[model samples]
Target: MEDVIVPIVLFSVLPVCIWLVSYFNYRKRLTAHETVRHAIDAGQTVSPELIEKMSLLVDPIRADLRRGVLFIAFGAAFAVLGMMVNFEDGDALMPMLGVASFPVFLGLAYLGLWAFGHGNKSA
Candidate 1:
């Protein structure tokens, strides 16, 4: 029972965490964009300072994605290893967890790419 529960929790909780982190990052970026919009509406010039601040806002997402990608790669490797081991013992949970990690990482990667590609709204 404990063995199954531990693996289940590990499999489920991590994906949830990854998702929540990505969601919060996206929300934060939207909030920052709104702030910039407000600043522009107030007749503030689009100075270098403002641009620099906006660029800084993306650092967190990039860091998170980099970390997420690494975890996904590691999870994939572990999943393959687990599948190989389970051939004899016949458990599928760990391999499932391994497969699940890839999407989370891919999502995070896409988020990063989107942010970087569209970051400059005021060119």
Candidate 2:
């Protein structure tokens, strides 16, 4: 029962955590935009630099590259875990490899996107 519960909680919590982070980030951006709107209504000069600083935009290609590396590393860690578990029990490796493949393929896709977008200014 504990084993089943632990896995269930872990998988469930991951999506919740991701959602929370995205929610908070959205709220932050909303607040920032509201502040800018208020300042504009007050007839204050809002400079482009100030907006740029507040926006904190990251390069999409660079972000993709970073995510790709991180996902690949994460997948590699899972693969290593699978190998270690396999040493203890023979049946664990294949299932873990199957699980690891998702992240690895996702990482490869991100890397491919990064590569394709690297040369394009609009990307």
Candidate 3:
């Protein structure tokens, strides 16, 4: 019972945490946009700097590179954890590698996007 429940809870929590993060970020962006919209409707002068500050935007290439590196680090951490858990004649590493592959591939995809976008930017 303990093993069954633990795995179920662990797997379930990941999606919930991801959803919560996404929801909060969406709400924050929505609030920022609404504030700008309200200010515009009130006949106030909206400056480009104000919009940029309110949006808290980062460069796309930089953001992608940062995310890619972060995800790769996460994958590496998981792989390390698996290595630490493995004992002589144990097959623990392969399962952990399977789990780590998701983040590794995702990081690679982000890196690819960054490279593609970086090449298209104007000097």
Candidate 4:
């Protein structure tokens, strides 16, 4: 049970925690962008301060996406390692390898979201 469970916990929890962190970070940046956009929409001058902050906020999301991808990759590698090493005959370690794909899929999904968000193109 430990063999099966430990990997699941690692493959599942690590990415989720990282995703949550990235999500919160993205949300914070989004809120700031909206605030700046609202200010601009209101007929107020686009201050240099707000422009600087917006630029800074936007730059990190790409980096965070990359970091999330890296975390997924690491999880996959760990899963592979887990699969190759046989602890007991009845152990279902390969299933855990499959489980690792969840994070990879999540990272790809986030990348897709990042791409979709590009240029703020709205219909």
Candidate 5:
């Protein structure tokens, strides 16, 4: 009963929180754009720095690297946990490795893309 309730509440609440966050972020961006537009329409001079900051994008390489590191860490943790469980209970080793390998592979792929595409080879 506790297990069922926990998962149900967790899954439900997580999605609702995520949706609220996403909605708020979108609203914030829209508000910013409206403010900038309104300022310009009102004959106000926008600073170059503000324009630059607003136009800046999240660095893809950095994002990929972050995800890769996080995935690798999670994979390693799961793999280690799987190994410990296997040693203790003599079951779930393959399942654990299987779960771990998914993230490990995904992380490796992200890192590979970052190295080959985003990072400078000559540097």
Candidate 6:
């Protein structure tokens, strides 16, 4: 009963929290952009420097590498913790391994993306 309740709460809460945070952040940025646009429309002096910073380019390689490393770390932690846990009748190690496989596989996929000429994209 406890196990089912915990995962259910976590799955629901985590996503909703993330969604709310992202939604608010998006709204905040949108508002800031709107303010700058309004200022410009009213013949107010807006900072071109701020606009330049807002239009910054993202480097995909750095992002992918960061994600790959983070995912791999999470996967390793899950696997290690899974191993250290004692389950009833030793019947659930497989389940733990299954859980661990998700991030490990995802991390490997991201690393593969990094390897596939992402470094050359900016050149």
**RMSD per model, one decimal:** 6.8, 3.1, 3.2, 6.8, 5.1, 4.6
- Per residue, candidate 4 scores C-alpha lDDT tens digits across 1-123 of 999999999889969987998899879888987898898899999978868767766564565568568768867886876667646534758777776777777777767766765555341
| Residue 87 in model 6: lDDT | 57
**C-alpha lDDT score of every prediction, in listed order:** 0.74, 0.87, 0.84, 0.74, 0.81, 0.76
Candidate achieving the largest TM-score: 3
Runs in model 6 lying further than 4 Å from the true structure? 1-7, 17-57, 87-89
Candidate that would win on lDDT: 2
lDDT of 3 by residue, 6-122 (tens): 999999999998999779767877888888889999999999999767644535677789889989999999898888878653799999988888899999999998998888754
* lDDT, model 6: 0.76
How big is the positional error of residue 56 in model 3, measured in Å on the Cα after superposition? 4.4
Better of 2 and 3 by lDDT: 2
Local lDDT at 13 for model 4: 96
Candidate 1 lDDT by residue in tens digits, 2-114:
99999999889989987999899899889988888998999987888887878777765556556667766676776776677778878775766657677657756755764
What TM-score would every model get versus the actual structure? Answer: 0.46, 0.69, 0.75, 0.46, 0.58, 0.59
Q: Relative to the unseen true structure, what is the C-alpha lDDT of residue 75 in candidate 6, on a scale of 0 to 100?
A: 89
Question: Per-residue lDDT tens digits of candidate 6, residues 95-120?
Answer: 77788899999899888888884758
Error of 4 at 63 (Å): 6.0
Worst 10 contiguous positions by lDDT, candidate 5: 54-63
